[model samples]
Target: MKTTSQSRMRMVPTITNETIIALIGLYCLAVVMGYGRFLFTATLPDIMTQLTLSTTVAGWLASVNYIGYFIGALIAMFVPQRTTWQTLMLWTAMSVITTMMLAIPSLPIMLWYLVRLLAGIASGIAMILSSTLVIQSFSLERRALLSTLHYAGIGVGISASAILTWWLLSLDYHFDVIWLIAGLSSLPLLWLLLGIRPDNAADANPQPRSIHQTYINFKRSLYEAISGNGKAISLLSTSYVLAGFGYITSTTFLPVMATNQLADTYAGLQIWLVVGVSIIIFNPVWGILAKRIGEINTLIGLTLLQALGMFSPLWFAGALGLYANAIIVGMTFAGMVSMTLNIIKNMNPVYSNLLIGLATLAYALGQFIGPLVTVALAGDNDNFDAGLLAAGIGLLMGLGLLLWFRQLPQKSV
Candidate 1:
């Protein structure tokens, strides 16, 4: 009986190191992207109410966070490869600290700006580092699937944030307490992160390089890639910018929109929750679909779908429109990101780092501008109809660029 049991156990497959690394990446994203970054979105309506903040001020606050994110991403692009793990840990710690700071009561608006900005920076650096860690650890054959799993962390984090917000609201906890609990909740994950050492062989004896050298190399590679695939790369980057602008308006204000339209806080929160759930459930499906179709096709389709989702609220009414918007947008946004980066990387595998870095910067700029533009379009009445329409138009323009790029002849890098 013992021999038989041993044999059965041997037949079962054990989890691989790549799987462990992917899980670690997921946790990192969940905490940083989901809680540290997006918790603001989930709690924005309440914060606005409690602080009596104007729509313009609220938009500025959100834009400040993205500005920090943009700077952090730019910083990450030049960070020495050898220090990625340490940098990730440092940023993760910062993320935790900054999140907790949001709990301080009656903080000055400038302080609020400073805290959110720091949190955004932390989230941005952690995001880039964690993604790099996961991708480098896995082999090409398994990369796509593992990456999908890693990206699922965004959805997991978003969903968890939404749920926690909903629960706290139900318990009549103020936004401060919610932020406190959210910070405290991440402590365990931080502890777990310490145990996740890099198993990649390259990490064993990494060569040191100065940030200046790294930047020069990256700049040189980027120039070569653009020189070779100028039109394709330009179109893709511009599309990504529009995508960043297109999705963020809804991402930031969906809950607030829900509360306004439905007049029910719980229902408003539920819409965000549904988005998280949809992202978690459908993100992997896109990876599978990409295998059957192609990355470009998948990306174009996603962009089109997202554009339609952006326009849905204008056409549909009440909770129905909000839910539709949430589900559709959630389903495509993350996939769009993964696909775009993948496409660019495939264009010039040697220069992929710089290519992806450039794409990310463009996306970040769009996100930084998105809320400010949306709020400006929203005007004194705080009506988002015009903003939503503009967002959809941006997506459509992006889609058109993608189609044009698709028609271009493929060139080997």
Candidate 2:
């Protein structure tokens, strides 16, 4: 009886290394991507009011950050696979420093720009490296479902920041204080991250190679990876660019938009919270749906859905439309990211890191363009309607590309 009981107990699944890694990834993302990146979006209205900044200035700041992210993704593409873990730790520390710097008061605009730019670079590197580590680990273990948990960190971080902001505002806390508190909150997570080592030999010494040789090798590998599936890859990359452009305006400005429309500060935060919660709930659903309907088809359906969400505020009245938009956009954006990366990784597992970096580079360029174009279209009155419309159109264009991609030979994808 004892032997049978022990055998049954052994059969029960327990916490595995991949699961622990996934959880660590979740927290790392919550800090780097969530608090480090989106905290600005959550606190933007307060920052603008406190700093006496114009909409155009705010748009410029956002664009500058995306430019930094673009540069970071470019750098990540060239990062040696053997060094990804160590490099990720370095960038994550940078994220913490930049987040804390935002707490400084009365800084010049140039300083603000520099800080945000640095933060963006940190975010981009942390995002790519963390995802690369978590997904590759899970894929090796044949536990792909864990990737959803890893991605869920973004939503968790967003939700946590929104909640913190909402509470602080109720207490009449200044934007600087909010920044400080957010920064300090990440310390525990960072400590936890430090204690957990990646499965990779992150401390391994690298073989000396000339920069020129490294670049040549990278170029050759990238070329070889894309050569067989050039058409499909191109379509996917173009669509991802559109996805980045289409979603960012909403990601960056939704809280502000809601506050403007509702004339209630808390209402906007609530809406942002809704977005976070929706992401947490639905991101996993997307993975399961992809299994049932095929990833390409799932991408098509979600792209169309998000485009509709982008247009909802224009069609519907008041906060109702904003809420609808929040839920739909929130649910789909993270899923789109994970799904797109997963597809590319599966395309060539040997070069997944390079593929992911390339995709991120494309996405960051679109992000860099989004705010500038939106602000330009919005003009002096700060009317975002036209910009929102443009974002929807971009998503539709991306949807068209996905459709084209789907029509390509299945073996190529």
Candidate 3:
């Protein structure tokens, strides 16, 4: 047996090969699981038509995932930090994949809600844990790079789901067929993750001093983060809620709205596909820009772009509007998700995890509220004009709140 002195020497380094593998694994899972969460949105039209779902029911189906997600955000804290990332991802992905496969649009609303809730919980756990896994596994220096890559997966997943949906719809395949294909993709990923293990989940960055140490370095870090954004987080929460309300309702109904009162609707899925691909390029650009221009200003630009994209439905009737909206919305939406994290990080590095959880909550809340609000306005005909008007109102409200966000005076560099 090794001596106590020898054991101490072996535990010195902060990062290892296991850390790198975990990063890549997290990145891949981000794509796979994201596709799982979002495929429903991508295939909403088919789901409604085939399952004979009402607008409210369909919106709830999509929003239910967020409800599960909201619950998962709280549940995540209870999970042992020392748990294996592989097992965590595996279990989470399985949860998403299983209910997703079992989902029958023809089923009663109650059963449908249950599946969405379960999926939300699973995907929520996996995504939150994945983000946590990357942060915990790497040193501070590489965290930003990893974050950029992380949201990039959302881009990839969006593109894949769009293209896949388009391909199936074009081939005249049934909507259920698409779900089967999407769910089966997870099986191979699960097999690949069989041997992978995660690093220690304990507070690796704990201050080097004793438990009794007052204001330890780690605690100080938390203080600075909380201090910087304590009030602002509340503001951030409000901004995100409004933004989520407007953006989710508008974006969720994008393809549908674009097709509304228009005769040309041939390539909506393809247009959405292009938006996904654009994010692969745009997310990193926004990241670098956020680091330079600061998060507040960059976020303003991000929201503005989304606002512009939202206007495409009204820009011109027919396919022209959709084509324009898809391109603009896709690009900005990509940045919004990635940049939100950057914004939270710049405000407070120590509470990044907590903030992430909070942001997730805010976003989920936005989803829950957005659909209900939109459906109410849409009336019985499924016209989203009221929702769109409310969306504008929400965006303006978010912009006003953002002006109050305290930060480094909108940096130029």
Candidate number with the higher TM-score (1 or 2): 2
Choose the strongest candidate by TM-score.
2
What is the number of backbone collisions in each predicted candidate, taken in the order shown? Answer: 0, 0, 1
- Top model by lDDT, which number? 2
lDDT of 2 by residue, 1-413 (tens): 75684455455343347778788889899988888888888998888898888889998889888888888888888787788877888889899888889888787889999999998899888888888876776754444578888999999988998999999999999778887998888887655555444434434558889989988998998997787888888999999999999999888888888888897758878988988999899988988888789888888888999999999999997898899999998899888888888888779877777888888888998898999988999888888888889999999999999998999888999
Candidate that beats the other on TM-score, 2 or 3, i.e. the better one: 2
What digit string (tens of lDDT, one per residue) describes model 3 on residues 1-413?
Answer: 33573354345443355445444554454444446567776787777777778888888777887788777765553443455364366556666465356445456668767777877777666666666655555556665555766667777777777887888888998667777776766565553343343433322233345545533644564465567446777877788887777677655776666445455543546666766787777777777777788667888887877776666666666667667767776677757766675666556544555556667678768877887888888998888767766776787778778777744243311
lDDT of 3 at 40: 70
What is the Cα-based lDDT of residue 113 in candidate 2? 97
In angstroms, what RMSD does candidate 2 have relative to the true structure? 6.4
Encode model 1's per-residue lDDT on 1-413: one tens digit a residue.
Answer: 75684455455443448888788788889899998878898999889999999999999999999998888888777665566767888899999898899899898999999998998888778887777766777898888888888888988988988899899989988789989988898887665555554434224345667879867887876687677788788889899999999999988999889988896758767888888888889889998888889889999999999999998989998877789899998999889988988888678755555567678777888899899989999989889988899999999999999999899887722
Error of 1 at 363 (Å): 1.0
Distance from true position, residue 301, model 2, in Å? Answer: 1.0
For model 2, which pairs clash? Answer: none
**Candidate scoring better on lDDT of 1 and 2:** 2
Instruction: Itemize residue pairs with steric clashes in candidate 3.
Output: 292-413
